[model samples]
Target: MSVEVNNETDYEVDLHDVQKLADSITEAMFIHPETEVSIVFIDEDAMSELHVEWMDLEGPTDVMSFPMDELRPGSETAPSESGILGDIVICPTIAEAQAKAGGHAVHDEILLLTTHGMLHLMGFDHEEPEEKAEMFTLQRRLLEGYTGRPAPKETVE
Candidate 1:
């Protein structure tokens, strides 16, 4: 498996941690060695345009995923052999905003969005309650592994 991370933000993120998380996210999805994924950190303006074009949302969102099923990372694959998982674009500015809203650290929020994007590439969605539960559960599990920390405490209201 191959992973690429490109940062376009002013805030400094832990490159090693992000790289490990990207690898873990790909492994969590059971990707083969032929799989490739990219993580790009962007500013609010660039992120907002992507959100508008892809999901038709009104403004910048935390993360956006672009799946390229035919391009694996690192090695050039024969057109038929590549399993391009996709690209993940994250906005640290938005993540910081959400960290405050969600009562979590900015790093934690960024981790959440990274895993969320990976899940989307793995055919997971949160359009329904049940789907949301399963996806979120998997996301949490993957995150736990990525961070070497306990899973977040889940509460039912």
Candidate 2:
């Protein structure tokens, strides 16, 4: 998979680590090897603008996903087709705050947000109780598999 990570914020982020996480996620999901996805880190202002424009919300959120080809996870026997998966936008400032609140490293929070955004790109939703449980469970599993450590508790609502 082609995972492109772009940092547009002033904060320093481990771009390589984010790319690796994205790769691991796609691999675990059985996405095509040639599939492409972009992960962008933007400032709070940019995130707020996106929040209003896309989601019609008032303030900046932690992450936002804009799916392209609307890909879905595939079975091992049949991986997803090669195409543009989607773009994941993240705000490091918000992530830092959330990290402090959760008592974890900011990088961990960013990774969690990225995982959540990628799942959204792959047609995952958490609006319902069952959907939230399934998505969060898969996200925790994926994160733990990649980091080789237990993922932080899910606090997203």
Q: Evaluated with lDDT, which candidate comes out highest?
A: 2
Per-prediction tally of clashes: 2, 0
lDDT on C-alpha atoms for all candidate structures: 0.75, 0.94
Q: How well is each residue in 1-157 modelled by candidate 2, as lDDT tens digits?
A: 9999999988999999999999999999999999999999999999999999998999989999999999899879999998999999999999999889999999999999999999999999999999999999999999999999988766556
- True-structure lDDT of candidate 2: 0.94
The number of residue pairs in model 2 that clash at the backbone is 0
For candidate 1, write residues 58-145 as lDDT tens digits: 7888888787773322322322244778888989988888777767788887888888887887677788999989988888899898
Q: Please, what is the TM-score per model? A: 0.84, 0.98
lDDT of 1: 0.75
TM-score of 2: 0.98
**Residue pairs with backbone atoms closer than 3 Å in model 2 (clashes):** none
